[model samples]
Target: MQNVYLAATSATPEVDFRFDSHRMSLKGESYPENAQAFYGPLLDAVGSYLAACRGTTIQIDVQLAYFNSSSTKLLMSLFEQFNQAALAGNHVLVNWFHDEEDDTILEFGEEIAEDYPALELLTQALV
Candidate 1:
């Protein structure tokens, strides 16, 4: 499958999914006017990649300064996909990065970790 890369805009985050390398990342803010339109293909791509791989290690990094409610829901769906992949025997690691003082983002990450026990989640505080 081809890799996916989308530049960040004022209302969305950057998407870098390198299927060949088994690494994906979403950075910057995400408040897209059409959350589904923005995330649908990405979720599909990930689903396809997971379906085709076995015993692979996938690393997902999320560094969002802010996201709207819709984005939050889509993000959770993305995490769920990874969680399912992990449950299916793939190694799925999720790195959630936030500012040291951003309690909100930290709490969100904690919530995700709590919800997706199968995922190896690492919540990191950036300086």
Candidate 2:
């Protein structure tokens, strides 16, 4: 499967995903006009890539300023996919970057960590 890379627009965040080498990242705000439409192919690509891996290491960096509830759900689903991949023995590393002043984002990261103990959840203030 090819890598998935979605560029950020005035209304969407950029997604830099590399599944072959297994280093993925999503950055910026995400409140797309249609959340499902925006995330559909992206999630499909991620799943396809994960299914092709055999003992691969996956790293994800999520840095978001804001996201709507729809996007939030989609992101959580995406993380769950990563969590499942880790459960199958794929080494997964996830670093959630939040601005120092954004307590909400930090807390959200913590909550995600709670849901997926198989993956490494790295929380650090964005510099």
Candidate 3:
């Protein structure tokens, strides 16, 4: 599958998904006017990629400074996809990076960890 790359905008995060390498990352902030429109294609791509893989190690890194409720819902869906991939026997590792002072982001990461036990979630505090 071809890789996916979306440059970061003021209201959206940068999406870099390298299917060949099984690595993906989202950075910056996400509060798009239409969260579904922004995340739908990404979710499709990730689902397709995960569906094609077996016994692969996938690394996903997310470092969003801020996001809105809509973005939060979509982000959880993204993590759910990874969790499913892990349940299918792939080694999925998700690294959630947040500012040291940002309890919200850290808490969100913790929530993901709690919700998705199949995938390994690493909450990293950025200083």
Candidate 4:
């Protein structure tokens, strides 16, 4: 599958889904005017890639400083997809990076990890 990359904007984040390396990263903030419009295709691409992978390991790094409620939902949806892919025999690792001063983001990551027990989730506090 082809890789997907979107530059960060004032109201959006940078997405680098590197299919060749099996590594995906999303950084910066997310507060898009239309969350679905921004994330729909990205999620679809990820789903397609994961569906096609035959026991391939996928790694994801999420370094979001902040995200609106709508974006939070989209993030959860993506995590769920990853969880499903992991359950299907693929190894998925999700590294959630939160600012050291932000407990909310840490808790959010923890919540998603707890919700998707089958998926491997790593929460790291940024320096």
Best by TM-score: 3
What is each predicted model's overall lDDT from 0 to 1?
A: 0.94, 0.89, 0.94, 0.93
lDDT of 3 by residue, 5-69 (tens): 99999999999999999999999999999999999999999999999999999999989999999
Please provide TM-scores, in order, for all candidate models, with all chains considered together. Answer: 0.98, 0.95, 0.98, 0.97
- Quote the lDDT for 76 in model 2: 87
- Lowest summed-lDDT stretch of 10 residues in model 4? 47-56
RMSD of 1: 0.6
Quote model 1's TM-score: 0.98
Best first by lDDT, ranked: 3, 1, 4, 2
The model with the greater lDDT, 2 or 4, is 4
Model 1 segments beyond 4 Å from truth? none
Pick the winner on TM-score between candidates 2 and 4.
4
Cα deviation at 104, candidate 3, in Å, is: 0.2
lDDT of 1 at 53: 82
CA shift at 28, candidate 3, in angstroms? 0.3
| Pairs in clash, predicted candidate 2 | none
Which numbered prediction scores highest in lDDT against the true structure?
3
Model 3 TM-score on a 0 to 1 scale? 0.98
Per-model tally of clashing residue pairs: 0, 0, 0, 0
